[model samples]
Target: MDDTQTMHAMGIDDAYHVEQVLARGPRGVTELVTIDGVGPFVRKKIPTVLAQRGVWSALGGSTCPRLPRVEATYELPDCVAVVLDYIPGLTLEQAVAERGRLQQNEAVSLAQQICEAVQELHRLGILHRDLTPANIIVADDGAHIIDLGIARPFTNTANRNRDTTALGTYGFASPEQYGFAPTDVRSDIFSLGRILGFMLTGIYPDDASYATLLADDPNITPRLRAVVERASAFEPSARYQSVQQFAQALTAPSDPVDPVVPAPVSMLGASNGGIRTRAIIIAAIAGIVIVALVAAMTLIPRWVANGDAEGTAANGTSQNAGPQPNTSPDDNDDDMVPSPDSSTQDSEDDDATRGDAAYDNPLELVETGWSADESGLVHYAFGLRNTSDSVCIQFPSVEITGRSEDGSVLFSHTQALMVAFPGETTYFGSQAGNSNGTVPATVDFTILEPEDYNYVNSGESASFKVDNLNAAPDGYGGEIFSGDIFVTKDSERVREQSSQLNVSLVLRDDAGAIIYGYTTFVDWPPEGGSRPFSMDVFDPPAYDSFEVYAQPW
Candidate 1:
């Protein structure tokens, strides 16, 4: 309808002038109107029949602070028009696009605010069946929830016999809403968690289906993940018992209760203002307490886990903390216990030429090129040539270690193949049966310092075995192994070529904290005309200093 026609139909005369259309939904349209009687107002147009059912009046008196204030409601010949205060802000969806994934702090803040709004609406016996990114607007001041056209009230008698159409966006709606059952505050909480998940990970959970999101990227804090999983439970009885409980779950830092599945909370006790009012007041206070707890829990974990490097750095207290004992490497060897195999003799023969096939002294070892099949699992080939004919070299079995970028150990395993020979090459790879146990391909091999290696026979070829190979995605975001392979002829020490190679490792546990790092260097035995080569591991936020280490090879 035209601006003049709508204004006249509502009996506002020339005093009300329509400016522009603001938003359009399934049940109604909202317009920005400038009235001479009132400066500016949002005019929402709904069907007269629907307004007569008292849905609009109930929603108009709701305590949801985020919803626009209703100024007036008038009936026209075929439709009903209600005037409301204009809310100015950008939608949450827009903010997400501009700022990739929000930090944990920002996400929790927004979620708590949304929960408070939901709690208020529920206290007033109203349900905002539609709660999605589009319905939530964010301003510099605060966030506002809008669009209550499909909102139903607890006291509506017609709602008892009404076959309301399923309402809500695909990804945001609770399962019960889709089943044509009564929606409660818990349903909104489920949508809130989905929104929080989207804010943390750039991807939305809805695009891939709720089942897929839960399986692949439940991108949230562990505690929050548990709550969201429960909120989105398929059964209604499995959901939060009340809006207060849902709000508590959203605002609570710890574990939360699941919703009811078989049947939602009955509305029998809702008429008594004393009981409902006390419940609402109690919920509000509980919400505040929970918000405080959530904030503390979210922020405290990060602070306590990060050590006191700040003060240490300021005091100039020797940047090198010295090598702390990493039980990780030794622990990884234990994980390499090979399964009983009938081809143990063949495996021994393969290791015979390489070296002594024992699991001791992994430092003296060498490996050839690595390869991976179509399945993306890697295999390393080691060629150990024994220079001494008199001494029978005993090769040690290989072991793989997994660590995060921050030096936190995740997994370690041992390979069964052993080598026993003066000079030979052997092949080793992730165990065939252990394919399903593969970690993310992005881990790193921790290169031992120069002191860690033992030189033999005039340093002809000092062997340095990598006892652990951490897997990684592309070997990025962590340490890459590179070191020198030096040889000496006499005490005069005529330096030969310096060998340097890069080895990539994977990182697991995206949420784990990083602790230590080191790097390797090339261009050994520097001459007057030779260029300098170097590598260093650095701490993040500010990677000013890094530990320098020498390789065994």
Candidate 2:
């Protein structure tokens, strides 16, 4: 194929011609080329040395939207090359270098979108072995997850069980990815979290060791820090179960409060006058409670504005105060957001009045599949019912969080919705318009972190009304749809059971070939309960299909 000057042996079509080299990597070089009628294109040629690496199949099944569109595949005598759509965007590495660290909100948004893209791939049973900033592209409109040459599908084969020669960018690879065991979705989450840490602090945590990063970044909020710390956990199981969970944890709102306790005169070692000490103690306690309440009021507004589910209301407004800051120099402040532990306080209050209420409600949820158009956006819908008459469901909010396979939170948002009456269902979906504001459907969140890729979250959900005419087929050969949902409740009754709902429609042709399909997930009952569930749809081919297979990374 290399010897042919025009239209070579790899079955080179006249439609495309090589232009120039864009970037070179260990596996191959990506080239800028022109398709006869299709404008700019990218052609990636796998080197002879890496020809045996089954990347073609990996790219085919990958759901990463940021990845270059796979136009066609070719098998050359000496090498293999795949043609793809040329994307116009800058590498994330460049964006960070130029802009320094991104603003917290911007970073979170970008990370969340990336996570959703990755989640799409993971849901299809694929994994991107190599994940790094250099492989990610950030466009003016949104970020793109590129470079899947080392990706592989999760099949029940020996290859999926064994470790490979550690293949990926060093700083971005998880410890377990280095031949410790076969890499899983969580492995990607670990790498994604590391990338996020680098994006936020400009320091690679895995390279310097997470402990070092924690010791150095004093400004890092505790909640954010906790996310990094958890993502960087040595053991894969210790990390988040999914990328959505990680994103939710990272984006969950927080408020600052003081930590001080008054000591009685007797406890203070017999002061000169017990009366004076008592007065001082009483004043201190009063001051602390009043100050805490005041801080709670100020912080709650910002927290709610950011769309976090943790904020609560007392009387009529949000009264939940965030965690107290640790004053120690070694404490990483950014990682220090209020823990979910505080949410129990509200539950305790609810438990006290359980018997007096007219009825008790067990949390339940229902969800529908997601749909998407040609532009590759996703949409989802869900139905929720307040089953109990006793518990006056006040401010109940739903949060949808996405995670990478490695359990890093990519994106999360607490959507506001009109309250649902008992036994009533509400419908919602992705925001209106495309990236250019043309299409009426678009995924609600954008993932900025690496872990945001290839993950899902529960609690928040999307609502939808059935459309029999638009329904698609289900299974492996069917088409798919995608979108999001918005859920909300008042702050008073926040802790409730969460639910996961899957929506899928199947289509079949006259020959019984799965023509089109749609599938998505929504977790409602929004808060606590139930283990994570996976969403998958597959159909076997009628005949032995000549499919591409790759060595697992």
Candidate 3:
């Protein structure tokens, strides 16, 4: 591969024969090139800004199954030329024109593939701001996402208030991509929603008849239609938070009660489990009268004491905010984002400690931010580092409060968090698209400590390790670390539940100072077997080295 990487040293015209001119526009010219010894590849000449060079360099090193691999990249004064493996297939746009719109199951299948691809891009910190049928190719291997001409990395700075560039393809770009709000992982999700709708309605989102056509289509399931509606909501926060979530929704069980709810369970996401409303409904109906009386008795005095507590509804911000680390001089200069925690579970006041370490409110807020847009949309995200040496505890949920000028709790929501193992950082909070847009005068985060939990001892310290670890470029000039987790415990001795591991990436500089972090849930290794995993960090402060934190999920 190093020998092939040197191909970029030669000029494009000198290295391969230009077989055909495929596209020409502001994204630059696209041509099919054929090498005598090699095969056909798509070469794109993309005009670059100071900000785009890093993205091009990263793309040159990125690798994903559903995305076309970049063979080489050449940078010029004005544009960067990228050579991508060419796959023969029709674009989804053309596929729809030839065959009629897809059925529910067909669209769902393809949508899942696209979601998987987009989720990977987001994981690499690249947002495919433009997602439409035309950018997807239907090939033998399945759907391949093409065209990163308009792709951009997630902003690595704290000043990312909005997508400064208001350029996105019409009909599919999220409102945030139009500079309404800052574009993040959710922006791509909005576009995928538009693509899903196009698959069923055969009409672009910008079309006047598109909405009615999609809603009135008898073939499209009401359940599927709801997915499209939520995905394309004008508010960025209203959309599925991540593609993994969107994909889960596409294949959700038809029965409302049985649906695998798209809850934000981790950095990458988890698929199983949901709230059983039947029991809740029965309990609610039976206790309404008593509950109302209880509420009246408990609320009146508390409401008086906590002036803005419930009244924060009018002064509150949005519900779910995407992750954007707010770094300050005193904080570690690392670019990170928050990820969701676990699903519903019971909590008890059981003080759990690990191997001589006592829990003393171990959470340290390393990064924080709160912002709102003119559209009344609000977003807030913060990174938390567990300072304890070996203590790992449950932060089942996080309470973020929006306070009034006098520092009174206006309103707050129980935000999710990625399980942060000892000495690692995880993000908390989500974007709320339909927020009141009121920027809180003061924001407070309260980590609700779990009541009871399990604690592992030091004897199992060497329970797992990465094998054949490999590091590659993540396209935005960052690095991707991948390896297989080999469990040291004997397969016969370990229970299946004990193999569920939560892994987090820790990137540090040459001097070993922390820079970036991310946490994800790994698939259970087969009864103490091994499973592969990768960590994508976009534009970390330094890429000198990395560390992986693995513990029971």
Candidate 4:
């Protein structure tokens, strides 16, 4: 559709003109439009039927300040177009890409804004099925959530019906969006957690990348990890029940008070205005808290308990202390636990030349390489192999020292430590500008000891079996493994409607050495039934065999 022609046809007020194209995508086109005597606005052509144009117009500016206000709606022949307040700013995605990662307090503060906006929408019975970073704009005023392409009203239960088509971004989408279940506020919470993780780590929250966060980052606090882990749990029941509750927890994890519920006022029978003011004051202070204490009670205990045991085993002299204050507020920290694959490695992958404890250190320097970017900035990358019996290994830091031709110090660069998986090599590097004309002749690189690591260990449970497993070559020289995990319901019937199920896949080389693998939490396979799963192992070695393990979380 011609934007200028469309606005001319509308004949809005005394004057109206198309300003510029804001964005164009699968949904439709968004343009900046200006109407004389009415100021500037944004117009979006929504192609999807479930778009919340009218709802947005009704709610308008009456709701949360972070939400865009709809000025008008037009039903075009080919699309439904809506005019909204033009929020000029960068998106959260753009901000992260430009700034690398957000500060801890900034992330939390922005998250609270997002939570408030989402909470208001939920209160009005609206569900924004797609709440990705691209849909959020970081304006000068605050973080504004935009795009309602797939938004559905609470009364429209058909929109909640299960479908095979995925409705959100791969890394941020909740499992239910992939037809596992219905989408709800919890799904948004899941995306919020993923966003929080990205803001903290500067990494997308994909299964593999997320494992790195759980495996290595010491800057991430235990409390924050607990919140993110539960929010992004495979099952909706495992996430924060509401955005408000999640916000409350983010605002104050130590507080026991519930932020969503309003305390009863002794002057409830007083004037309406007075009661409204009282409620506002309460809401302002109550802050936020979401979900039941059950998830925290269940997940945290196991994380702490298992992490304690694994820390002792991974670092013999490591202290297994209670959760401590985070050193880097922007980074996330969690206690590492021993995974199930750890045991399998010990029993099957032992080498004749090396004793069982040979892989205890698990830190092996792989290779270091450097390249220059378009701006002549030299980027240095170093790879490390984790030969640990455990599935995951952590590194505290990496330092590169350069010396001049005379053997004098030239420059030094230190990169933060990272997490790597068994059979998989992880890389960390830094970029430096060589404008000083002092290129070093000799350079020494060192891998420092990791602060802590949790061996992700799980035992073979009699309750579940991995069947119909198949491995094939991916087009990109990688291997793709697919299989089904089934639970054999017996005396240990999961009477509850919800349960935490964790699954892992391990591949071994010809010498029985671990090479590639993946671990993920999934919704409980149907009672006495199975759920399909798949994983792509990039640049894997020729495998002699593989192993799959499942356990109820």
**What TM-score against the true fold does each predicted structure earn?**
0.42, 0.42, 0.45, 0.45
Best by lDDT: 3
Question: What's model 4's overall lDDT?
Answer: 0.52
lDDT of each: 0.42, 0.43, 0.55, 0.52
Q: Tell me how far candidate 4 lies from the true structure as C-alpha RMSD in angstroms.
A: 18.4
Give the 10-residue window scoring lowest on summed lDDT in candidate 3.
Answer: 295-304
Judged by whole-model lDDT over C-alpha atoms, candidate 2 comes out at 0.43
Model 1 alpha-carbon drift over 4 Å, by segment: 1-9, 37-39, 62-64, 155-163, 209-219, 256-553
lDDT tens per residue, model 2, 1-553: 3466424544464456767877553345678888765668888777454553445655566546665667777766545778787678888878887877666667778788778767777776777766778778888778888777667777563533324333455456665443334677877888778777777775544333445555454546666766766765645666666777766666876412222232232211211211123322332222111111111111111101221232111111111111222221232313112233322323433232212211223223443222222221122333333433322232223343433345654333443222333333333332111211121222222111111111111122223332222212332232123233323332212212112232333322232222222233333323323222222222211111111101000
List the candidates ranked by lDDT, beginning with the highest: 3, 4, 2, 1
Candidate 3 structure, TM-score to reference: 0.45
Clash totals, every prediction: 54, 91, 14, 22
lDDT, residue 200, model 1: 65
Residue-wise lDDT of candidate 4 within 193-228, one digit each (tens)?
Answer: 888888877777643456676444566777777667
Candidate 3, 1-553: lDDT as tens digits: 2555445445555768888988654335689988886778998876554236655566655677888888877765545678889989999989998887788788888998888788778777788777878789999888989977678777763544344344455457765543223678887888899899999987766455677888875788788998998888755555777787788778776422333344321211112221123322222222111111111111111101111322211122322222333221223333221112222222321222222222235555665444333332234445666554554533234455667578865455554332444556654323222223344565555555433232221121224676777787644334567888877644321222232454555544344433334444455466556888865433223235656755543
